[model samples]
Target chain A: AQKVTQAQTEISVVEKEDVTLDCVYETRDTTYYLFWYKQPPSGELVFLIRRNSFDEQNEISGRYSWNFQKSTSSFNFTITASQVVDSAVYFCALSQWGAQKLVFGQGTRLTINP
Target chain B: EAGVTQFPSHSVIEKGQTVTLRCDPISGHDNLYWYRRVMGKEIKFLLHFVKESKQDESGMPNNRFLAERTGGTYSTLKVQPAELEDSGVYFCASSQVGVSSYEQYFGPGTRLTVT
Candidate 1:
């Protein structure tokens, strides 16, 4: 069985502040993939990033960055200088290689107050 | 190109009522998928379609749900006699073949409210 756990249920921060959302996963498979998605108030899910198990290198894209630590079985996302438009429900998901389904976490609701 | 699109952005129905949700994948994508998220719960996979064939449907909750994709184009999921527990947001996604990235384009989702 595969599972993704996002401990933070909700977080609020003022505009221009940085926020980090935690994600932990459990999987027996030796090879797997991890992903992060953002769901805004419109209810559409936007794919953010995808990381493979073999590559534990940290990734950064503009104001968004991700830390992948195979040692901790954790994939954390950080948003620098978050704006009001960045407020959304962030999800952490896992999938085994060639697997048909994606296992998702409970998600973290982020609110950025301007 | 347009992304995945789902019909009836929102639906409200009583218990034992029937409802149908539709999804139109990208113009040339061959992989289609369905997922749902109940209130306060994690999103779950319902099924997957490779072209017009059902690749996997192990996550479908029960027999009351039926899905079909004709001519390997649009897909439909019909829930006969929906129950309270079936109330949730249904999401549709699609991916192109040979895309090993496992990245899927998602739809806006259809919110179903069962009374």
Candidate 2:
């Protein structure tokens, strides 16, 4: 079974500050996919990023970035110069190949204070 | 394109009552999925439908949960004799066939409150 762990339950950051959310996962499968999602106050989930197992490269999309390190079984997401809109509950998920199911971690609620 | 849509954004039912939730997938999407998030827990998969057929339903909680995708356009999930533990937010998502590597578009979930 694949399990994702996000240790941070809640985080608060002032506007313009950078924040990193830590996520660690355990999976026996050699190949799998990692994903990040954001659920705002409205309770609608929005897909953030998806990284395959083979790719350990860090990714940056605008002010959002993700670091995937297979050696530590960690996939961390960071937001730079964060705005108030960044406040939401973020979840890290894992899925194995040939399976449509995504195992999600308990989300981390981030509050961006202006 | 319009994203996946779910009906009755919220539902309240008494214990032992039967409730059905509906989901309309994106146009031309062949893959549809159902997931739920209970209080203080992560979202868990309930089932997956590829067109009119149920591709995988291993995550369904029990026999009381029945899901069907009729005509391959929309799907319905029926929970009989709902328990208090069944209260949660149910989400529906859909992905286009052969599209950009299984990117699923989600709908605003239905919050089921079983009392």
Top candidate by lDDT:
1
For residues A1-114, could you state the per-residue lDDT of candidate 1 as single tens digits? 999999999999999999999999999998899999999998888999999899999999999999999999999999999999999999999999887478999999999999
lDDT of each: 0.94, 0.92
For candidate 1, what is the lDDT?
A: 0.94
Best by TM-score: 1
lDDT of 2 by residue, A20-114 (tens): 99999999999989999998987778999989899999999999999999999999999999999999999999988767678999999999999
Candidate 1 chain A: worst-modelled 10 consecutive residues by lDDT: A95-104
Pairing residues by index, what is the TM-score of model 1?
0.98
- Fnat values, candidates in order: 0.87, 0.68
Which tens-of-lDDT digit does each residue in B30-107 have in candidate 2? Answer: 899999999889899999999999988999999989999999999999999899999999999988766343677788
- Compose the digit string of candidate 1's lDDT tens values, residues B47-91: 999999999999999999999999999999999989999999999
lDDT of 1 at A22: 99
